[model samples]
Target: MTVMTTHLESETAEIKRRRDPFLIILWLVLVVFALLWVAPIVLIAFTALKSNAEIMATNAFTPPETVAWSNFSGAWERGNFATTFQNSVIITVIKVPLGLMFSAMAAYALARIKLRFGKLLLLFFLFGAMIPFQVMLAPIFTLVNGFGLIDTYPGVILPYLAFGVPYQVFILHGFFKAVPKELSEAALIDGASHLTVFRRIFLPISLPVLAALLILDFVSTWNEFAMALVLLQDRNMWTLPLGLMSFQGQFSTDYGQLNAAIAMTVFPAVVVYMIFQRYFVSGLTSGAVKG
Candidate 1:
């Protein structure tokens, strides 16, 4: 019994010793990555607080003697963030729901339905994923212009939908395909119509994927600049990204104000991610496992 206990104790100590090195290495790697990731944000925060003169005089690595709380307020007003924020909200509200619905419906059909050309359609959308946004800009702009949608919200929203839909479809299709067909068949046997099965059965099981896709789509639409710049010619219709660009001029740049504006622009996305992070993580994990 004494010899057996000694052997087990030695084995346990060996296992712990082996684990310690890996744990130390992992923690060191994480710390280095954290510092690298956080460095830019730290710099942005410091720059936002400093006056232009102070920024020029002092090393950017050093913190300001006094935090410029007013920079945020000033940037807010100067950037016309109130109006730009409203525009972003409107575009997001309209585009996100519509995009999700269309993408989900298309994905469901492609995944579940039996059709001669369904695979072909899926391949076509996959091809779209490989095409760069810049490649389609000219043709897309011309088409929007021909439709008299220039300088309008629809002009920008429509293009966003067109570009965003293919990706949404691709992601959701994999998720939908992974869902057990037994549940769907059982629902149909219970006299549930196709629409009812989709709404009541498929949707509930697919919430994780849906939530993940919504967050992804919202972030993309919120940060999108190129389409907004090209489509929205009017100041009133300009989204936050386009409005923020107005802060830069030929003569001089408001570095403090620009940093402040950037911080604010980034704030909403951060807040949204925080709020939905739990669901986002769970959904992504679940989708990956199931898919």
Candidate 2:
């Protein structure tokens, strides 16, 4: 009994000695980052509740003496959020799913199906991902103008879909490629067509990745600015970013209302992330490692 107790105590000491300092450093780093990220958001919330006069007098981090609840309503009305919010919602709702579907289909073809010149096509997509959107702005504008799509949702939506697909396809392709070949082979042996396999097997199993992409694509669509600014000439057709831009005038800016609008703009995305966050980490890391 004495010898057994000594061995058990030695094992506990060994385990304690083996505890990595790297984990402690990692957690400390994570906590610091978490606080860093949360600070700006908290500051924005604080500023949003202040009056413009109060904002001008006090520093950004200072809290309001009294919560100015009207700032939210004022932001909604003054920013023309009613119209801009609808336009943003319309673009995001239409663009994200369509982009995901198209990306997923392309990824499936590239990763699962044996296609002619598949490597070349993938390289083409990767090249497209590297090309900056700023470089394409002139050509895209001209193309949209030629199609008479300017001042239209299709104008902006089409461009968004095109730009977003390359990266999304890149992400989904990796995840799809990592799927077990045996699973696909078994399905094929059971008389399942490629399309059937994709729809039934791949799609169901890829929910985490799909949800992750959906959230990412949704936020990108929601916050898109430059293309929307150029394509959507009509004021009523403006999206949230454009609407937010209106807060800054040549001579004067409404900081409080601007911050309020910002808070509101960020709210939907926060809600979306919260809802889909469970799948986010898993989805991103899906194909990162292999046994």
Candidate 3:
């Protein structure tokens, strides 16, 4: 009976020991922030369900009178999402891999090869990264027109590749430099070329950084609007952002349809984040250890 009583007292102490007030407070704070973050999304979802008249007639926080799901299908059709979505997918699919490959190659050379003036060249790329994209629009437009790429896929794609490479190379260079030199030297002694070393040694270890860059580039290219607006003139060639412009009339806007379109357009990037979120922190940090 004494042993049982002692065991009960020990269990109660253990339970109290496991509880921390600061941890509970921290969690409560996090919960508040999380709710604050999700509140916008929830509001947008509710707004998407409302009619245009209902939206203007009621309070912003009011529950939508009806869950008008047709807004999605209507927006899909009226916005011509089929073609715009296709263009975005093609651009993302081609650009992500192409950017990564080229960036990785350039980064490897800059980080590992000891090329003459490599720092100057990296400075050039960093300059490109720092430049205001809006300032480049006129020159880029002229170049695109001069090359006869106006309203074409090449027009849109080339700019993405050019801008995409610098930041990617910047991040990847740090990562490549962080890789131990002896490993590559060992590979070379075993009859491996630089190409083989890159493929077999460097890339395998650099997956997290690469994944983070991939997600970042994918989201940026997918959501790009200003450049797309200037380059693409034909309605048929319009990407998702341009297609959303169709919902805005000079006088009035289709708020329900507009909100629905936004949700759909944002869905892919959100899904990509969810998939790669685990790798993101490690990827961004591990590359910086040696840099």
Candidate 4:
């Protein structure tokens, strides 16, 4: 009994020793990663505080003597961020939900229902995802213009939905397949219609996937420049990205103000990701593994 207990104690100590080194290495790696990720943002913040002269003279690594709270306000007003922000909000609000619903519905149909040409339909959507956005730009522009949608909100927004839906459908099909069939069947037996089952059972259980897609779509739509640039010719209808580009001129650049504007453009998306981060990871992993 004493010998056996001693051996067990020795094994436990060895396990701890092995785990301790791994833990230390993991912490060190995470610390390095965090610094690398954070360094650029920190530099941007620092530059935003400095005057143009200071920014040009000093090393970017150096900290400013004082925080320039006014830089944010100036960037907001001068950059026409108010209008840009509203444009982004309107586009995102309309596109994100529409994209999610359409994609989710398509994914559910593909994953759950038996239909003629279902595999072909899914393959078509996947093929759409593989097509480069640049290749379709000319055709999309012509389509939007033929409908007289150029320089219009719907022109930019509708094209976004059309392009974004395929990938969203692709991701969500995996998630839908991962959902247990019994729950859906049980709902059906309870006299729940397909719509009702989707609303109550599938949606509630699939919140993580939904949340993940929302963030992903929001980020993509918010940062989108090419389509917004080509479609929206009117300055009044400019998104944040298009508006930020206005700061650059042929003569000279305002480095301090430009960096501040760039930072402002990135801030909202970062806040959103931080808020929904947990669901984002869970949804992505769950879909990938289970599908």
Candidate 5:
């Protein structure tokens, strides 16, 4: 009877410990931070739905008196979003896959092959990634101009591909290295070529990382502004970021419409992240502590 009573008391104490006050406090702090983080997005959403007059009259946190659905239509038409959005899609479509293909091939070589100066080669690639894109802008523009490719998709795409490759290679290299050696070896022993092994074995296991990179690279390519601005002079060729800038300028006085344009600009990336966020999180952590 004493033992049973003691066990009951011990369980009660454990339950109390589990519900520690510090843990509750920590959760409350986290909740506050989460609200803080989401506040700007909430504000933007509210502002997008409001009219210019209402926005001016009320505080930023106030709900709109009436939702202005026309703001989106106005933004779309005035912003030339149809043309700019198409351009961005074309650039991202062409750039991301080519970049990933090249990066994957380079990473596969680095991971599976025993090349002389392999580490040096990797450092060289990493070094390129470390260099600021701003630093390369002048040279990139000059090169594109020399090619007579200004305002062309190729002009914008080439730079994006070049800038995208190094970081992608670094990520893929880590992922490829983490994959089991035995799988590749077994495939090789079955008379598979290096290309076959890479295509059949490595690529299959690397889907999470690839999906993560797909969304990330898509966002980067989609949001790229400086290089696109430098390379593309034609308004028709302007990507969404540039078009958004034009939209903002055109509707500078109209906060509702401007915010609507801002919302439209961010929507695609947000959707992409929402769709692939599971893979993104897993891919980032997969190679961090290789078992």
Candidate 6:
């Protein structure tokens, strides 16, 4: 017993020695990475507070004489953010939930439930992720025009759903495969339908992948510029990304207001990630472990 105690003590000391430096190194790396990420946001925050003259005359890196708190308001009004923001919200609100439900359900059906063409359909969707949206622009434009969705919210929302579904389904299908068959089998044994099992078992277990995919979809749809620019011709139908173009002039542009507009645009995506970040890592890992 005395020999065992001494051996255990030595083992504990050795572990401490190994762990301390590794932890220090990890923390240092994290701090450096965090600084790199925060630097741009800090620059944007400071730049957004400066006057246009200040941004032009002085180096962009220079701090402003006074923080122009009104820059946000100026950009908001000049950019007509109210209208564009409403359009984005309308698209996001209507798009994200529907996209999530459809994709998750499709993934569950493909991964869990039996289907004849499951592999072929999944391959088709996975193939879409490789296809650039730009490549399909002309055809998609013609289709939207034929459907009379031009310059309308449905125009953008529909395309967003189309693009979002394939990728999200790909993610969710993998996660659903990771879920223990026992859970679904047990539920079915108790007379639960596929829909009931999906809601209770798969949905709860799949939260992480859901959160991560939701964030990805939200950010992509929020920042979508090319499709919005093409589909939406009316100023009233413009989303924030399209409306940011309003700040440009023939020869000169308001750098301060542009930066302010950008900061506003970035804020929501950041907030969304922050809210769902806790689930992101777990979701990614859980899918892998289960599989």
Q: List per-prediction Cα lDDT, in the order shown.
A: 0.83, 0.85, 0.84, 0.84, 0.87, 0.82
For candidate 2, the lDDT comes to 0.85
lDDT per residue, candidate 5, 1-291, as tens digits?
211222235877889857777667767877999999999999999999988888889999998889999889888998898999899889988998899899999999998999999999999998888888987788888999999999999998888888899988888898898777888898788888999888988888888889888888999998988998889999999999999988777778888888998999899999988999989878877753454
In terms of lDDT, which candidate is strongest?
Answer: 5
For candidate 6, the lDDT comes to: 0.82
Give the TM-score of each candidate.
0.87, 0.86, 0.86, 0.88, 0.91, 0.85
lDDT (Cα, tens digit) per residue for candidate 1, span 1-291: 211222135877778856666556767877999999999999999999988888898998799988887888988887788989999999999999999999888888899888899999999987777787977778888999999999888988888998888888888888888877797998788887878877887778888788887888889899999878878888888898888788655213778888998898888888877777778977777655554
**Tens-digit per-residue lDDT, 163-226, candidate 2:** 9989888888898998889989998998989989999889899888999888888888888888
Better of 1 and 3 by TM-score: 1
Query: Which prediction has more favorable lDDT, 4 or 6?
Result: 4
Q: Is candidate 3 or candidate 6 better by TM-score?
A: 3
Runs of candidate 2 with Cα error greater than 4 angstroms are: 1-36, 56-62, 250-252, 288-291
**Model 2 — TM-score against the truth?**
0.86
Candidate 3 residue runs with Cα over 4 Å from true position: 1-26, 51-66, 250-253, 288-291
Candidate 1 scores a C-alpha RMSD against the true structure in Å of 5.8
| C-alpha lDDT (0 to 100) for residue 276 of candidate 6 | 87
Task: Give lDDT tens digits, candidate 6, residues 5-114.
Answer: 22135877878856666556767877999999988877888789998778778776788998887888988888888999989889988999899999999999999877
Candidate 4 residue-wise lDDT, 201-258, digit = tens? 7778888889998899999999999888889888889999988887554212766777
Pairwise lDDT winner, candidates 4 and 5: 5
| Error of model 3, residue 239, in angstroms | 0.9
